[model samples]
Target chain A: MKHTISVLVENHSGVLSRITGLFSRRGFNIESLAVGPTQDPEVSRITIIADGDEHTVEQIEKQLNKLIEVIKVRTLTKDECFARELMLVKVSCPAEKRSEIMTIAEMTEAKIVDVTLTTVTLEICARYQKLERFIEIVAPYGITELVRTGTIAIQKGSETMDRKK
Target chain B: MKMKACQAMVECLKAENIKVVFGYPGAAICPFYDALMDSGIKHVLVRHEANAGHEASGMARMTGKPAVCVVTSGPGAVNLITAIATAYADSIPIVCITGQVNTDQIGSDVFQEADITGAAEPFVKHSYLVKDPNDIPRVFKEAFYIAGSGRPGPVLIDMPMDVQKAEIDFEYPKKADIRSYKPTLKGNAFQVKRVMAELEKAKKPLICIGGGVFAANAQDEVVKLSHTMNIPVITTMMGISVFSDDDPLFFGMLGSHGVPAANRAVNECDVLFLVGARVGDRAVRTPLALEQTTKILHIDIDPAELGKNIRVDFPLVGDAKNVLTQLLERAKPMQHDEWLAQLESWRVERKFATAKKGTVVPRQFIDKLSRRLPDNTVVVADVGQNQIWTATSFHIGEGGRFMTSGGMGTMGYSLPAAIGAKIADPKRPVIAICGDGSLQMCMMELATAVQNDVRVKLVVMTNKRLGMVRELQTKGYNGRETAVFLDGSPDFIKLAEAYGIRSCRVTDDRSADEAISLLAEYDGIALVEVIVDENEATL
Candidate 1:
């Protein structure tokens, strides 16, 4: 099962490797990880969704805490968090089929970022599943290139990651 | 309380950040293994002393730290020579601790007595023979530092049986001050400038790389040089993935078994600028014959490499990366159209790979296996054809790494070292590449991998013969295969199964595909055995 986790860490070299390393070393599949700077320049937040049993997650949290760079880590389950994923996918499109591709993009509320001689780039933002589904349906159009910003999570209630237990 | 040499060794190990060691217990080395009890420095007993030494090399490669291998003196120490030489060649930081003959019997040639210090000197960076127990602490500290620092290579500490038998008011020295041993970190300014001036004047320049590029963490600098100069870069097998192929200037690896473009470029280029590498037989198989009038500038930290093969016009005996940075200041911006064009013309779909003539091509299997793993996975390749294939076909990502016995070319390296790498970062995927012959030399370490819960996927290119020798016979000799194999080989999957590790076998492309799928999906230590025909060329 995929469990979202918010990990706060010191901005240090090799810290990201250490975080991902814990899951990999433990033989857990880390679904996705999105790391970015918070308001504090010294601290960065790593939002990770990893597949593991509760004990494995508990171990992961403990391992993260053990790293000198890690400040804190907390499980941000789907029920307690609101999340979105962003992706930019370039699909092969014939000149005549451009309008048909644009129409599909419009219905999904995704914008067409670029149109080249042979490809059309679509900008998407939604739940991970929604984006995946959109891409799956459009894959027959031929995915030439893809870039996804993994997934980022924030608590649904007024509580921020730092404010939550 | 009188501390045994074993206890003293443990104390030194803890101070050196050594989390684990691989070894076997003998009459002399048994006490040290016993001392490991209650000691946090985990001691893994291998099936043989040679494997212990090889494992230490793997550990060092995996963790970027010095690794220890302990064994009894005499035959045991002799066993470690091949392993030590491999570390020496690859420049992996390994500190070997061997049980020696009692101090009283120095030259008596008693049973299990050998001049281990004298034996190891030619191969090791530094060899220390300790007679007194008091020197243990200082020697241990120095051994660790020397093994890991500067050019990273193996160092030996042979403790007398009496010394391990004696006690020490052990005082672990934190610093080492050796007058003769200070490594040159900064390049000579004048030489650097001279190089820079030449680089500018030459329209066609190519950078021939060695293992030293990665050793100095000069990947960025190398990338900078190639980008700024628009110079094509070719590497020794050891220098393989230090830079990415996506980098346009990457001419691919050079030497006898190198990419045709790289070799052809070496022949075609007017200026061959060697950086931080030894122009070995592998790098410059046809050093004598040049397609064009080539001028070579050998830049290496070790002075011996300057005139060793091809006489160096500019023999700057300094660190390759350090000197290259200095040369960057003076290197010109001239480009050669004809040279670049001719070099490009030499390319024939430019793949650095070969196949087994008699049976399955190992490169195809290894490349397929490598593709299944994540781009950032680490492959610890043993010496021989396995290392060659790994260097050629395993496309490393930004963090994907390849570690092997480059200098000594030690066979039994994969399994144990992967354990250390796995320990270094348990979450990152670590795989070991070995041949069937090499795998037998260190197969006992499967126990170590399982015991530590350090799972490193073991991928063996099992050809059931000494593939390197086989290659040599074909390439160098008249296809005369010698003492290369025994009739029956042990069932590796069953062997791994015995150790409670999952395993898969790949005989054909179909089994290869299925095997790759399973190996990638499995979490713990999995053995993927690929059967290649006996007639394979390493290059």
Candidate 2:
């Protein structure tokens, strides 16, 4: 099952390695991860999407809690969280098909970040599936550059993600 | 004052007053090596990283402090897994710091790029990966707090190359913020009153003390409570020195090698007041005897530990010292001179007579050694027969200590742990006594003594076999020995000699006396190898 892990860590060096290390050691595979600064200057929030055993995820959350630099950690399952990913894609399109691709981009509300003769780049931010479907629509345009910020998320309510009874 | 990152790290270590560290350094940890060159901190370089972790765990077990170790990343950190788990299982406080790839190159899969925090997560109480030099001190502070507080266990910190090389203004944070961490300080007063009420109403009241008494630094508190309450105190392996064995109210150790009267008393007692020690398999052999005959009042630091192995009629959570001191304030100090006299009679009926084999028994040798030891002498014992000898026969007078890895019962804890404990309080004499099997497990640590010039006496009873297992077989098995005997034991004297430590081999009573005399006169680490019959069981 897929679960989302939110980590609050001290803003410092090697913090990323620490977080990633936690995933591997606890036997949880990180399918996606997004790290960025939070309102608290000293702290950063890392949102990671992992797939593995329920017990393994529970353990990963605990391992994350052990790091001194990590202030707090919570794991939110797919059913209990609002999650999204951001992607920027550059694609090759014939002059005749440019308008047709633009229509599809409009339908997905993807922004045009860059454009050149025979190439059109669209920036899309949405749920992972939405990004994938948008990519599939644009796949016909001959792919070029594909960059993405892995899944970032927050739980639906005032939940502290401790499932142990 | 500007200092190197490594130097600041060492200063932070010194601030914790951690005098001993167990590790095998490499190119990756060269910065730490440079800082260690002229520092006062004693570093015990083990043959392997796992041994370092094991040694650190041993030290923590002995000192009730968070022991430290350094290992380079990748294989070095990975090598420490089993020992880390040992600390976790036993809740020994240890801080493991490993080298890491530079911050920028960490996920780039640069040279020696291994996820140390990830690898150590499951086996540790906590872990950190420091990418910024600025956070090093902060992480160090938090690591110690987490590892040594709440429930003690191992904590790992992976310092990347840049962080280890980078420097910033440094000052040890005088305090730590652990809003998430709040350990139980005192038990509920009402509950303690209830226990007192029960005690007031009970006829046969018994006390079982665990390692918590020592861990909580409540030795005197426990002794006071036992004597004042007039309850017979039976200690588990970890609870060995909470009260002296010869005290008026002291019942010898309980469990497998327990006095028959103590075990029988466990059956007769109407109320069992267990402080700090859990009712483990060795302490409570069968459910029929322990199930319903006695009302149990369980008190421990960790809430999860209450009723974990056995059911509890009353449970309290907090530091043992606080719990005990508070219990004294509210408890009625019942005078049970009649009950005490009955116990004294039982003691006489089941007194363990020192086997009068012309050959010196291990217990007698340890007793002689203890007598010659100084007032502040610290003795570390290996598990198996040696622990039985130390717990039952050896005496710890005021100002002395008896330390062992009892809860974990890990073999080979003596030598390296002795180095760490001796370093912790150098003025106090430290000696390690081990069985042949356990000494072999961590004997490489004798070199650890030589490397740092730490003086801790190392004594091994060489039976040329796994004597404990063989003894168990004799008691429980049908006389068939399986993988018990060592074809030919290595010369431990020569092994200690390789480490530049003074050593000797003693076989008979005269030689044993000479060995004890030499132990008192020696100025540095000494290895005394005593030859003993494999057939003799510890009890």
Candidate 3:
């Protein structure tokens, strides 16, 4: 099963490397990982999408909690949390196909970020499923380049994951 | 007032109440060594960096405090990796300080430089690389805190040469505030009640003690619980000395090398309460047997250990001492006379035979040594056949301690570890029991012992071969022994004499008793080499 785990860790050098090293050493397959500064500047939130069974996921959570820098860990349930991914894709589009690409982007609510003579770049930010659909629709035009920011997640309601001390 | 970072490092150690250090120095760590000279901390210069780690680990195991080891960059630090891993496996607290190349040379592949922190990441509880001198005090404080805290393990601090040279105002923190690292000390009230309920209903309850019981200093609590409830207690190799062998409720060790009686009891138990034990492969050799017969209630400090290797029925995540204390409070005094009698019958049925008269038996030697040593003696056993012999035969009396590389099974741990244990408390008698193969791995430490006047009795069980591996081949591979025999092993007595240490060699049954007397009477470092039959089976 694929699970999204939210890990809040102290903002310190080498912590990311330590975490990634753990995943690799344990042979846990990491599907996607996105890290960014949290609401507290001194802390960072890492969202990791990993594939594992029940036991493996439990081990991952326990191991993360063991790390000194890590503050909190939560495996976000699908209903209780909202997740989003951002992608910037450049697709090959000639002048004749530019209008058609723009129509598709409009349908997906993706914004045009840049346009060149032979390529059109679109930026899309949505739930994972929506982003996947948008990419699939754009694939017909021939994707020249693609970059994803992975996924960032938060609880659906007002429950905040904060450090106790 | 400002001082060099290296000086501040020494001062920080003093503030942490560290009295001794085991280490090997090199060019990268010269600055720290220079500062150590005036720091007033007793430094035992180890023969090898790996020995330094083992020595520190021994001290930590004996004293229940974080031991310190210092090494230089590259190979110096690399050599300590195995020791660090061993400490991690056994949950022994050790602080390993390694000197690095200058800050500018860090990532440039300069001379004698290596990524010590990177190499140690998997094993260490926590690690730090100091880039600034001002962070020295904080880093040391955090290192000590992390290493000695709950589920204790090794922690490393890699200090760059430039950082050690730079001057800074040293201010050691009174406490480390690691918000994410709070270890649960008390067991949950509801969980304690649940365990009590289980105890009340259990007909044939067994308590399986692991190394965590010793780590939590809950030996007394566990003993009391076992005696009050009339429960049979079996130990993993790591938990060997947690309960005395003579205790009526205490059964022998459990697992692959375990006594047949203990394994049979575990296979028959209705409810097995595992306190501070991980129930690893060695301890639970036949998991299916346990799963089919017993309902396991695992009490451990680390949540990760619960249901890790086996499915735990009742999980209590708390310090062993606290959880055991709570269980004792809520537990009702009960007796299982029938169950106890059945266990006793099993024990009597599978008792080992007495040693034959002609040859020097390893089990007989251990039994003789156990009787000769004082009640408080600390026995450090190296890995291999010697370990199994000592584990099965050595009777640890009250106040006695046994230290070994149970988890990692590292060879060459006993001698230096004995030195460390003796150094920790000079009043207690310490012994290092090693096989010929194991002793040769770190025999140079005899020089360190002589130089420091550390009185650790060293016993070498000489079989002229790697007995354990040879036994494995004999049993599993149709007796085709290869690369197991030591064709030309050195004369250990001469080697000890060359190091200026007193030594003796024992052959035949009569000389073995004489060797024991010599070990008992010796005041400083001494070695006793006992010749044993090479084909003696361990299991």
Candidate number of the best TM-score: 3
Query: Any runs in candidate 1 off by more than 4 Å, and if so which?
Result: A1-165, B1-6, B290-292, B327-342, B350-360, B471-482, B534-539
- Model 1 lDDT tens row, B127-186: 778877888888888888778776788888888777787777777787976533556667
Candidates 2 and 3 compared by lDDT, better number: 3
lDDT of 3 by residue, B58-96 (tens): 999888889999999999999999999999999999999
Q: Rank candidates by lDDT, best first.
A: 3, 2, 1
RMSD of each: 30.0, 7.8, 2.3
Error of 3 at B25 (Å): 1.4
Question: What does candidate 2's lDDT look like per residue over B104-213, in tens digits?
Answer: 88778667678777666667777777767887778899889888876688998888777778777888888778655667788899988888887777788888888777
lDDT of 1 at B515: 78
- Model 3 pairs in collision: none
Sort the predicted structures by DockQ, highest score first: 3, 2, 1
Leading candidate by lDDT: 3
Q: Residue A37 CA error for candidate 3 (Å)?
A: 0.8
DockQ of the two-chain complex in candidate 1: 0.01
Docking class of 1: incorrect
**Distance from true position, residue A153, model 3, in Å?**
0.9
By TM-score, highest first, what's the ranking?
Answer: 3, 2, 1
